[model samples]
Target: MRAETGTRARRPAGPGLISKVGIILVGIVFFFPFIWMFASSLKPSLEVFSSGGSLLGSRLEWSNYSSVWTAVPFARILVNSFLVAAAGALLAVTVSLLSAYAFSRLQFRYRDRLFLVFLGTLVLPQEVLVIPLYIMASRAQMVDTYAALILPFAFGAFGAFMLRQFLLTLPRDYEEAARIDGAGQLRILVHVIAPLLRAPLAVVGAFLFIEYWNSFLWPLIVINDQDMATLPLGLQMFSGERGTDWGPLMAAATLAVVPSLLIVVAMQKQLANGVNLGGFGGR
Candidate 1:
């Protein structure tokens, strides 16, 4: 009996080791680009192009960072990026939470059908909407303004869907108890449910922030002024009409990526908890 038990334990242990190895391998594969970008940012322009140095061989040339700053209005771009991202995230989360609550807890005629219509928007690519959205923005005289960038993405179907799914998993007991105590819907949502929903809200906010931070397409189309351009658009100017300057380009890329990386690292635990907690409730 003892020998048989040992064999069963050892069999599962073999697969566990294999799974760990596979996960490590995948992580390395995914992280390689960022590693390379950091390394390249440290290399001189000539060294960056040269194939001779080891990935970690070159001494860190910190001057590339200074050169990058001088090469572009990175500070302004950073501010613009921050504003757009922050505003978009705030609006998206606020709207999504309310919408999710309505869909999950409150019932009205054709609610499910309305949700289905909202979800159907997810099927269409953002590219298809760009031209029409741009035209509408032009008509509204919002083309060159921050409103042009922030308003379009303020509410997203994905945010609504994800938050709704998360909200569905929560026990109705808290809401019922709140009502029994004479708490209204808004009061219950603000005092009771919102506090409990923090994990999922954090997850949603983190994702929306990252998405807005990295957005390049719509900003490029609408924002023509240098002062209003986001980091991704400003970085494009560095390429020039001649040839790409790799060192400074890498430097700018590194700077642009830092906020997103930090946000992800900070919220990673919350994101995981949100997803896990959200899994408990059914739609």
Candidate 2:
């Protein structure tokens, strides 16, 4: 009887062990690049090249971070990134919310068709729009300006669509009740609907912020002045005149990733809840 009990206890352990192994393998796969980047950033330039063959290496040289910082206007680039991302996110969320509310709740002719056209823009990649956008920016003499970066991303179809879907899921009774209380549409939007939309708004804002923050191609194309360049563009400078400086480059790259990582970590709960709400509500 004791032997049978021991056998039963050990039976479940096999699957548990396998599951743990699978999880560890998956973790290693995902964590390997970050580990490599961090490790490379801590190595001296020569050590970085020498240790290239192994995933784990001997010594750590921490001066790469200071070298990278002094080599570029990293602080200014960081500020520019934050400003562009924050402005774009704020404008995108505000415009999208208002537009979505109108499209979802207001009665109008061709509303659905208009929204469908807006939704169609989602399938169009930003690469397709870059040339024309660049020409327009040049014509307006806005190249290398914050307006060039912030204004273009201020309105996004995805934000509008996501917000519209979320607004649709909300009970109309609240709006109706507010209306009966002599609250104007703007008042109701501000005092009622906006508060309820905190989760979805955070999700949309977070997404847009990350997009603008990490945007490389557009900034690389339009920003000619070093002072106007954002973090991604500035970080590209580390690739160098002769060959890539992997240690300082990785250090700069790691620093560039910090803000977005903090943003995600800080808003993770709101982001998750918003996504879930938007998903279930859409269906």
Candidate 3:
């Protein structure tokens, strides 16, 4: 009986061990791209694709990063990327929050219909908007301007819809209490509602940041000046029509991943909270 009980106790460990092994395998699969990029960044241009050696460089070319930066005005490109992405994200989030509040809390005629129309825009491919947006910008002489990049992404229907869902999950009693204390709409939204909104707002902001940060097509079409080009354009130029400088390309690509990683890490706790509350919505 002692031996039997010991065997039974050990049986449960099998599935637990299998689950851990599965998770480890999944993590390795997901992390391989990053590993490859970092390894390739240190490789000589020719060695980047060589199959005979190990995954990384046989002799590390550490100078690739420095050389690549000096090859062009990379700092300027990075700054442009940061400015356009950050400005677009902040503006988008602010507009989404206000639109969400109005949609959730206030009553107006044809409000639901208007919201549905907004949602309809979400299903439309962004490619469809390029020509019309370009024409408007061209007529306004806004092409190649920062406004062309930032203004187009400054309002997102998806952000409003997502934030509206989150707002629906918040208690009206909180707003009622704020109102009873003689708080005005703007005051209540600022102090009472905004405080509770951080997690969802972070979620929305993070998505917007990532979207605008990686934006390629719109900027390519609108921006003609080398001075205003973003990181994507810089990377493309690095890989000229003749051939790609793989080592330098990977170095630039690795550097490009930093801001997104930092943003996600900084907001990870709030991001987790937002995801946890996703089923019921959150604010």
> Whose lDDT is greatest here?
3
Candidate 3 clashing pairs, residues 3+ apart or interchain: none
What is candidate 3's lDDT per residue for 1-283, written digit by digit as tens? 9999999999999999999999999999998999989989999988998845477677889998997789878999999999999999999999998999898889999998998898788887889999999999999999989999999868779889888998887779989999999999999889998888888888889999999999999999999999999989988877777798988999999999999999999999989887777523533
List model 1 lDDT by residue over 246-276, tens digit each. 7788889999999998988888899889878
Instruction: List, residue by residue over 1-283, the lDDT tens digit for candidate 2.
Output: 9999999989999999999999999999997888888888987777777865775457677788999879888888998999999998999999999999989989999999998998888898889989999999999999999999988868778888888888888888988999999999999999999999999999999989999998998998889999999988988898866988888898998888888889999999998899888533663
What is the lDDT for 52 in model 2? 52
Off by over 4 Å in 2: 1-27, 56-58, 278-283
Between candidates 1 and 2, the lDDT winner: 2
Provide the overall lDDT of each model, using Cα atoms, as 2-decimal numbers.
Answer: 0.87, 0.88, 0.89
TM-score of model 2 relative to the true fold?
0.89
